[model samples]
Target: MVQIKSSKYLDFLSQFGVGGAHPGGLSLTMEVLKNESIDETSHVLDVGCGTGQTAAYLTSRYDAKVTGIDIHPIMVEKAKKRMKKDQLPVEILQSSIENVPLQDAQFDLVLSESVLSFANASVALKEIYRLLKSGGRFIAIEMTINRPLDKTEETDLQQFYEFQSLLTEKDWIHLFEQTGFQHIHIHPQPSQQQDNAVLEDYHFSESIEPETFEVMEQHFEKVLKYQGILDYRIFTCTKG
Candidate 1:
């Protein structure tokens, strides 16, 4: 088994139990899911599922059999609780994406939102490819760096997000291809206008751990400073 380093940043998100931490939030997830062919027969996996929001949506909306996996135990617990409360049948597991504790070729769709950049992208992508059945789809929304990051900016981002690797749009496509994924599609989300109102809306959870809060503060600062360089992308691929 591969050893996966625990991320304090991820721990923060799990502790706060944020429902829509991804770029476009749950609303965007709904829009993307709308285009996919999902139903009672589809077996879906939500990689790095946080608080079970997307998993619950998949079950309630499409009635698909959904399984969620996250690296944090607290996240798994919270997700399971959310599913139980909503009376949705979702199996939530606490495990790293690089080494998911599940059988191969079991899922028709694998969904990841703002997840891959934080892990060893190559390893995670390979695992995702292995988990999908032939012709299965992989859809992900992830943070990307459109331009080259200076040494200082790169160091700050790594420190703030504990990201294993930050890739450009091209880099992402290369990795997907190297992992034997085909029919790749990349869509970049429109950049949000950086305004005072948006910055003001940024708030840290009071319940977050003190250490996590400090990191969050640093992350917020960097995001504000380098807003133009940071990008969010949606990728869809198929395993042949």
Candidate 2:
């Protein structure tokens, strides 16, 4: 089993239990889901599902059979706790996207929100492909660099987020195609920072590390430093 080394930045997000920590946050998630062909009978998988916010929403909104998996222990625990409190019948597991412990062709939809870049995208994408039924959809909201970055620029962002590689829109499509995903589509996202910053909810852990505070501060700093270069894209494709 491949494990994601816990970086301070990732640890901070997990410890804080920040739902919608992805670029567009949960509102974007709702918008994306609205366009999908989901029903109560559909089986959905949320890879790198931090804290189960989206998983819970899937059950509440579409009444879908949802399962969420994350590599971080804290995230898995919090996600489980969330389901227990909400009384939602969502299964939360601690696992890696590269090698998920689930049967193939089980899910109608699989989602990765700001997640694939943090792990081996090729391996994870292949795994996602195996998990989805033929004609099922796979949605990803991931960071996409508009242009190639200078080594210094790339290193700064990569080191901070611990991403595998800074992928562009084209690079991502190539990956999808390589994984046999057909009917690839890039959905335009409404700028989350257009008028107001996306509203974020936090469930703070009991024990907070001082360094974790620095992680959040540095996160905001990187967001400012990178700006347009650190943008994200919503890619939706079908398995065929």
Candidate 3:
């Protein structure tokens, strides 16, 4: 009779070491980065970087100086292991994105993948802005509802994922504007492709609780029930 609720779902994902847990997965990530002006000299920070999938790709693909941070201990450990195994010099840190100990204006780019909704978006945005150099860009592929949800709908979904708030596209824009971000853009989401088994990105933990098995069922049910209402968007902006 065990079950997972709230942020326990995050623990489930972490224990299973799910990679590309973000919406649209790694294929979309590759497509999105193609538009960015990244190179070997650029310094990049991947906030809430789960298991370092994107971080590894950033290093191998663009050869950018990449650093990854996540609040989950298991995730941080896995990310570090990935770096060590691949011999990639990507620095991985275990820290909350809301108040990282990094200096101001230190990164050329900051990336958040399906992470901010689970955090205090306002606080995290400010910290991300502080970490970016002048004219530096910030991009996030995060949850974005198309419209507001009623109390029941809101409670059910928010409780499942432990989202601080379910933000609409407009709500997200307001947060960005209030955070003093400039040239904010909501990019079109790519069509979700099927998971490629050959490139499967799961690194299961040595042990998993029986309660965690119910999480995937409940998650699928919610996604089906909400459908279009639970969609996500790609948000891009710059710090002045």
Best candidate, lDDT: 2
Each candidate's TM vs. the true structure? 0.89, 0.95, 0.94
lDDT of 1 by residue, 1-240 (tens): 444467767777777777767888777777788879999999999999978788888999999999999886777778888888789999998888988989999999999999988899999999999999999999999988989889998988887678887999899999999999999997656466233233121223447667877866766877788887988888999999
Which model is ahead, 2 or 3, in terms of lDDT?
A: 2
* Clash count, one per candidate: 0, 0, 0
Instruction: Tell me the deviation in Å of residue 138 in model 1.
Output: 0.5
lDDT of 3 by residue, 1-240 (tens): 212224877988898999999887887888889989999999999999989999999999999999999988888889998899999999998888888989999999999999998889999999999999999999899998878899999899878889885899899999999999999998876555656555569889999988888987798889899998988888889997
Ranking by lDDT: 2, 3, 1
Candidate 2, after superposition: displacement of residue 160 in Å? 1.6
Where is model 3 more than 4 Å wrong at Cα?
Answer: 1-6, 192-198
Estimate the lDDT of model 1: 0.84
Task: Please state the error at residue 110 of candidate 3 in Å.
Answer: 0.4
> What is the C-alpha lDDT profile of model 2 across 1-240, one tens digit per residue?
546686788899998999888876788888899999898999999999998888888999999999999999989999999899889999999999989999999999999999988999999999999999999999999988989999999888888888885899999999999999999999988854432144466778999989888999999999888888878999999999
The pairs that clash in candidate 3 are none
